[model samples]
Target: MDPASSIVTPASVPDPRATETVADLADQLRQLRLAAHRPAPTDNPLTLRQLAVLTGLPHSTLGNAESGRVLPRVEVVYRIAQACGVPDDQLPWWTAARNRVAGRRRRAPHPAPPPPPRERRAEPVPDQPILADDLLLELGGTAVDKAAELLAGRAPESVVAFLQRLHPALVAKLLATMDPVLATGHLSGLSPQHAVACLDATDPGTAARLLTLTPVTAAVAHLTAMNPEAAARALAVMPGTALAARLPHLDVDLVRRTARTMPVEQRTALLTGAPLPPAVTGELLFSLGFDGSLALLRAAGARVAARLLTALPADPAAGLLAELPARDAAAMLKQMPAEQAAARLLGMTDRQAAERLAPLSPRPLGDVLAHLPVPCAARVLAWFADARRRAVLQRMRPERAMPIRWHTETATYRLWLPTLATEAATSGATSAPTLAELATAGPPPPALTPGTGGPAATG
Candidate 1:
């Protein structure tokens, strides 16, 4: 061949296969556009501007897609196909061809295979001198001491996490060496069982401080697990509200034991300040017995005593009142507002109300009784000895006392009439006292004089 003929020009060479070049994708797009129906009523295919409108793509972008200097993104290729009326099923094929050309153009050269991992001979561990037992102990203790020193200043959350992995005895030692507030914070994050174990190893005062900082339910669990004496000491130092909230949930015997461990004044302060449940209050008071309970109530003062009495169930409240010296019971009642005292008494049996109220001087007694309804007042008064009842009624205003006195006498008569009839029948006597005679028999209650300080009379 001649030299010129042998030098083939680039333009004279054939193009690469359609699947391998971006121009193939561009040509495909052009063919799709020519075959697509025109948007306007004219004998022409859709123009790039019309196609851009249909595709919501820029006109220049559409022209560039057809120029084929760079491959359009697969998404752009798919959108143009859709605008050019490519069938839904055929749309993916057009994108696949675009992606194939893109894959060839952007393909990275294959990396050389990684060299086989080199194997090396294992090195022997250096020989260590065997440590004596005592030396090992000293080293271990030093390590623990260092850890505790460092951990003491760390955040509670991290300290707690670290402690959770240690033995309980060691945890307790670390906690005990830290500042109390920091230790308490860490203790609070521990599980109840773990916290209890740690607390058991610490001094009661420190244990108490930790428990007070802990959540109530968890603290209670710890208290329950601790020795009663220690728990009581802890409780004694805790805030009144915290003590109050947790005390009632503990065992009665344990609580009683706790009370015994505290100083009398401290016990009174804690119990009085705590709003213990009625049943728990009753149980604790009963466990203390009359003398201890009386001493505590006296120290707590009459107002607190009245509140405690009023919160108790009727049987226990009445029992406690009856157990008190009459003077003290009367004093407690006087400390309460008349209406409140009356309401408290009304909740008790009439006999209980009368017994508890009997020692109050006539004025205060009449004040409290005045808040009772006439019939209720009468029922309560009928339980009083005749003379005391008369004195109380005499201290009231006539309008208030008369109706109550009448009801009192009537109820008393009705109560006695059956016994009188029984006696008469047994004796074979023909006559029993008539209702009128019986009603008249007791000396009429002395007429009442108005008294200041008596409660406003309820009709």
Candidate 2:
């Protein structure tokens, strides 16, 4: 009889009953590998040594995996499967095989209970482990800055609790000395409401800057938990991009609630403040991530959203619009005054604008056009390249397209154009003639001389 006859191959089905013991499970894995393996024609059948070389795992590790004393780890099973050239589709079977081994080990019966213990005299408990604050206190006379730097590296919750127990002046000093990034990490770990309270306690400008340094998510969370008025004040002084980047993280409902909390004066200021410098605008937009910026823009009423979109460089502006959901994007377009919306569309190259606008549904597109001043809407439509223009027109109902047709032929300029030209034309013209121009062209009766004219006027 062959010695190998008793050995099970990969072809053998796993016997669920046979896997009751850890040792038995390890044997099954070894047998499965031996059965499933195929070696090159010139080579001897696959061996553990070949598998070790192929897998880059130490031969000793493989040896331990096949050892019956303990179960192999998941990585070990994966490595073994790779060594055997298992197909991708069949990898799950190996995972299942490993899980079976793990489950069997878990189900092993617990050892019998030890005999009941006899009563004994109680012993005093060891002194409790030192608190973090106690440890800091032990650093007597250590610079507050140094102590803070050390503590900043520890878990935030622990540091916060320890810091809260210290004098406020000392806490302020410590925070001033700590790295902003490190402080940001620590602050983020606090509950949102608590973080807001802590921030509120700090100097407002410092608090706003510190919040900017925090992860956008954590910063937004604290802001969301804070009063809208307080949040608005903080945002007003922080980097514009910091707030802009965080805008999307606020949900639509949350935005409405926060917006409602602001006094009308604050709301107007927030909506119409001086634009951030171009560099700051770009940075803020980039930080928001495309999805975030788009979401916030969608929620923002049209005029404010258009102002923000217009501030971005053309590429970013086009990219953002391209990614927006058709309905939301169209709604925003519709909300803007016709000229402002048309101007924004004109800012992008015709091809770029058409491609982005193409996906919007007819009704929203028609609604936006219908509300637009006919001439402004016509100009916007004409700006598109012929092919795109034709395609867009096809999407609109004939009635919707009529306004554009009637207005397209009418030439119009911005309302300020004539005022600007008039200013330019009369800029060189003065209320009184210049001495040189008036000398030859003025009233003929004054020809006598400067001396005679002055004497007569004085008399």
After superposition on all CA atoms, what RMSD does each candidate show versus the true structure? 28.3, 22.3
Per-residue lDDT of candidate 2, residues 205-226 (tens digit):
6667767866576677777776
What TM-score does structure 1 among the candidates reach? 0.48
How many residue pairs clash in each candidate at the backbone level? 0, 2
For residues 145-189, write the lDDT of model 1, one tens digit per residue. Answer: 576665543333445666666677878777777655456656766
What's the distance in Å from true for residue 238, model 2? 3.0
Q: Point out the worst 10-residue segment of candidate 2 by lDDT.
A: 438-447
Looking at model 1, report the run of 10 residues with the lowest lDDT sum. 1-10
Query: Would you estimate the TM-scores of all the predictions?
Result: 0.48, 0.32
Output the number of the TM-score-best candidate.
Answer: 1
Report every candidate's CA lDDT.
Answer: 0.64, 0.54
Which residue pairs clash in candidate 2? 10-35, 241-284
TM-score of 2: 0.32
